[model samples]
Target chain A: MTETELLDALKAALGADVLAAGGVGHDLWAQVAKGRVREALQLFKGTLGFNVLVDHTAADLLKWPGGHWAGVWDPCQATQGGEHERRTQTDGRFELTWRLMRLDEKSGLVEGRAALKCRVSDGEAGPPSVRDLWPCADWLEREVWDMFGVKPNNRPDLKRLLLYEEFKGHPLRKDYPIAKRQPLVAPLPAPEGRIAPEQLRPRVTDPGLVE
Target chain B: MTDERDPQTPGPGSGALTQGSGPPGVLTSRLDAAIGWARKYSIFQYPFVTACCGMEYMSVASGHYDMDRFGAGFPRFSPRQADVLMVVGTTSQKIAPILKRIYEQMMEPKWVVAFGVCTCTGGFYDDYATVQGIDTIIPVDLYIPGCPPRPENVLQGLMLLQEKIQRQGLHPKPGTLRPPIR
Candidate 1:
């Protein structure tokens, strides 16, 4: 249908779960409840034809000193004069931004995109996994867990994507120390069956040995 | 093939020695100079490329720069085949162990070149995620500092590795990764 109808469909289906909805031009966005994230994503994919999960990542807002964060979201919420007017984040330290776009059914060209955001504060068991809706969400969600320490519930293979397993804290978190380094797995010993270096280069000084 | 029979005693393999000035040089050069010279010039380098510096490495190795002139033209993808570990970019904490493992896998008398500033001292990525300097993990023979370094700088680093290669000699230490001498 039209751009307005898609967001309207989301609102009609999820009701109060659609906390706030707005768009400037075609950049439609909505703030949905954290618990209902999977349902909202399923709605976008199932009925709305928004098949592409463009991006899924989180921002740690602990030191955000927030206001308008780069998007022209809701003019009323825009704090003036650049003071430390911390924007309310639903009592969560982290916000997950999921951008979904749909392909035009006939032309196969992309028609529009929607930004679905939900805040997940610490001490909560993060948001529900949308990997069930989109397979790509599996790695994206794992990356979020890898970088921000926010694990999506029900993700089976929630392992590190970018960092090594021995990596300690999520470096993306605001409070994580900038210079702290966890000890590495001790440099591995040479693999078995490999010839020793000394054996590789035997000492030979008796000029007679060259014959 | 007697060293005692010596240079004065030239009754050998058509300079049968001459074919390689080589493979026989590999066996004969145990005399030191020829083997060291061969190893220095024929650097089968393992380009452990991980970041933007890779672009510079490719340019340096390409025809315009002619890394082949230095005898280090061939890039061995397997660490076992490579003697020079050209650590060509940022070695993050994640890749540090893998880098070390590759270094471990390499045959002895191997030389490591930290080919960029991020690899040298972690450069602008002085963050928790990047290894502060690869030297903190694997031993480095030369640190070529620059943000991804100019192709000229990379060549200079390669030349330095060649010099180090010439000096490490046939005498071997099993696993201790030593720093560059002066």
Candidate 2:
């Protein structure tokens, strides 16, 4: 289906939950209410046949003016480029995003793709974990939690994946100090024993040496 | 049981180099000098390599640079067997304690050579994650300065360590002071 047809179908199905739908570069994108994200993502996967969860990530939006996360016209979006501008703002909140792809079963080709974004406020719980629908979402949700400190509801293993357990804060957050160090109090034990140098001995069977 | 030759006389092939005719064919030197000479020539090194400088260290160990000529060719993986510790990269604060432990584990008569600018002064990583200098943790015998020091510079540093070892007396404790080299 085309971007418009899919979007219209979504608007009809999700109604007020579908806040805005438009074209982002060559792909269709939609911003939904944070509470309705799980339902919207389920519709996209079950009804629209966007079965493939291509990627999932988040952005910190703390620095935007008055907690107003910058949008397409914002100068901060220009740093990366125009293509990324549409999804750059969260109005002083975290923007959680997921890219989903629709693949044709017969041809084994990608028929369509869409980006779904949801604004999650600071200290507010994020969308429900999609791990039940897409198994790959397990690690992706963990990564989002690790980097942005966004808690995905019902995620079984939401521990830190990139940083060590002793790491104090999420590094990707804008507030995290760049130069702050959290060194370990004690070092891991090293292997014991002495390694001797390789030994070299002449062969007794050598005719020249035997004589 | 004495032969006809006089004990006071310089023996054949002595070439008039005998001092005070102390003993024929016997050379005399201080105990410290003899010990220093032996220690200077056999430096078993433990290369605590963690960054890009390890590439240069590889070249120094390989046939072209020939680190064996300076008697520091054997790269001991264990700290217990090594006589010298060559720290050769950017040591992060996380890894500093490990380096300290390795330095402590080495037997007495141990020396440390900071083999790159990063190991010596943390190089460009002047941040909280990097240790500003290894000396804050353990004493460094020599510092070889380079982004990733050239193999020649590493060899020069090794030679300097050898010279230091030769000039100083071996103390019973590992980190004891010795008289300054002239």
Q: List the residue pairs that clash in candidate 1.
A: A211-B1, B13-B16, B15-B18, B22-B25
Which model scores highest in DockQ? 1
lDDT tens readout by residue for model 2, A1-211? 7776888888888887786566633367888888888998999999999989999999886655443333335432343354322433345378889999988888999888998988888877798999888999988888888888897866645787655566677877877765565665442222133121123232112132111
Question: What DockQ does each listed candidate score?
Answer: 0.19, 0.08
Query: Can you give the TM-score per candidate against the true fold?
Result: 0.75, 0.64
* Candidate 2 Cα errors over 4 Å, as ranges: A1-58, A66-89, A97-117, A128-147, A185-211, B1-24, B172-182
Worst 10 residues of 2 chain B by lDDT: B13-22
What total of clashing residue pairs does each candidate reach? 4, 1
| Chain A TM-score vs. truth, each candidate | 0.74, 0.74
